[model samples]
Target: MGDWLRLTYFNGSLWRRFLIDYLFGIVVNNICAVVVAFVILPGDPFFHCWVFSMCIGSLVMWMADGCRILIWQGGRPSLPGLLGIFVVTIPVGYFGGSYLAAKLLALPVEAVLNRQIEHASPLLIMILIVCVFFAWFNWSQSELSELRAKAETEKAHMAAVERQAMQAQLQLLQAQIEPHMLFNTLANLQGLIALDAPRAQYMLDKLIHYLRASLSSSRAETTTLAHEFELMHAYLELMSVRMGARLTYSLTLPPELERFAIPPMLLQPLVENAIKHGLESKIEGGRVEVVAKRDDKRLKISVADDGLGLETGNGVHYPNHGTGLGVANVRERLRALHGDAASLTLEPNTPQGAIATLTLPYEP
Candidate 1:
């Protein structure tokens, strides 16, 4: 449809445009006046034709230039400026085009050709042209203004819709994590009660504290770097109790990088994944390490563990989806939020094990 409109509106192939201007628009309109002149007075055909062309074509020129100046000079000017230019420019176009027409057509003189008395003054017709142009110009301006305002309104509405959708999705992710985490903690506490009643009670208290802290922070979509790291530590303590020190860990964080902002629970899933996939498969023991550092314009966090890494079957590195839940969720969240400014990469650790590293924009 757009292509068709362009083809239709811009169809005047050079010479066709010239013909429309001089022959169709200019010549045809004057021919009517020329016919009128012939009926009024019966002498001097040459004089009548020349007078008719000059008087009529001048008005055409006025309308053409007036439209251009009003619509095309970047923007329309004030009423006074427009009226000033219009009044002065119309007469100039009238006389100038008349002079050119006479010279080109080999008329003997460029002056008004007839001695006929004025039936209507040319000035009155000029005023009528101004009134017509103003009517058209005002209507066009009003339409353009409405279109621009509507476009802005639509743009703002779209932005608000996008923001609401984002917030809802973030809340949903948090909601999913909370119940899953609570169930896991309960499982750990139940096993502890069968073995050591005192330790089970301690674990219950810690679990309660963790839930309390989570409830306080639940309303916020983002948290301070220090708070997220603290949450990571608490989750690891529960995992440590469940695994019986089979998954020893280390956290090496630089001191000054603890004030940045990041999405809550963003790191917990990645850490959980490292333990679930990389450490749980091993029989003897392994360690998962959390390393955090601040680069010039980014915050880098890594979760690494020593155990079976990316699963290999039939010589293909196929991920174990049963244990890859947290890793997949973190990757999706990072991409949806930060675009290309953030990155999550999973690769082999030094000798054996999987390492997941996240590089995020450090918002202070």
Candidate 2:
């Protein structure tokens, strides 16, 4: 409650604002006092005019700032409101300050008025000077407020433009992934058709099922872990038909994490990489295991395969040693989406083959 009153309601400390107002009041009143001393009261002492001007200016500044804080909540008031404040403040400040100044100087209030009237009437001249100063102050404040509002609008526009550009890049990367998987599968299917007819027909059926599941997921930005695991099962089954006994796979998805959201096809490329790069070229192909688990505040997923290890039959990695198209695509997408909070790393799996691990912050 104290914070609300002192900070939130006033948009800052009220005492600090009061000090600033009073400081400005002193400067303005000094200028007015000098003008009155020279032009209106040439014979009277300058010190007397200075005292009276200070008292009146301080009172007027206090009243004006108080009204602004209470009614407009520290925001700029309308022109009518600004004029009304001056209308009310001038009379009250003049009468109150006259009385106060006279008491301070040890004289009757009537004596101060009589002396002012003896010269060219300093009261009317002081009022004119104050009006001009305040009018300029309010105009400058209005322009500053407009400039601030324009800057905020431009900042929002730039953020929206940046968001749109990032989305477009994500879509373009996803577009590259779909065709890469499709062409590779089709090439394998063509080879199988000439070597084995019945097996090729079975593979075609599996491909139909795989495509149905994958086509929808490929178009989406995010999917549940359950759907992703299900898609992986279909894909592995299709690949198994082509590789015969050479390909073996397992998918482990915890029930608690089934509904968790991940970018669509985020795991598919990793699984494809494990099989194509780690196992396919070897005479005795090995197993591919895809596991998902939560670790502290992060999600950890690993695609491990026991096959020919990092080096293929030719001693060089398939597609480009462990950082192939699939790895590069996944890495780039992860970086774009999560910046430094997410990561993808390749390491040698225990005993044999390779492991691709993805780590990202877990959000429930």
Q: Write the per-residue lDDT of candidate 1 for residues 22-128, one digit (tens) a residue.
A: 44444544554565446444464756455645554555545554454335432345566656656665555545545565566677542442322243345336434
lDDT of each: 0.66, 0.82
**lDDT value, candidate 1, whole model:** 0.66
lDDT of 2: 0.82
lDDT of 2 at 96: 80
TM-score between candidate 2 and the true structure: 0.66
The alpha-carbon lDDT assigned to residue 86 of candidate 2 equals 84
In terms of lDDT, the best-performing candidate is 2
What is the clash count for each candidate, in the order shown? 0, 0
In candidate 2, the residue pairs with backbone N, CA or C atoms under 3 Å apart (3 or more residues apart, or in different chains) clash, namely none
Model 2's C-alpha root-mean-square deviation from the true structure amounts to 6.8
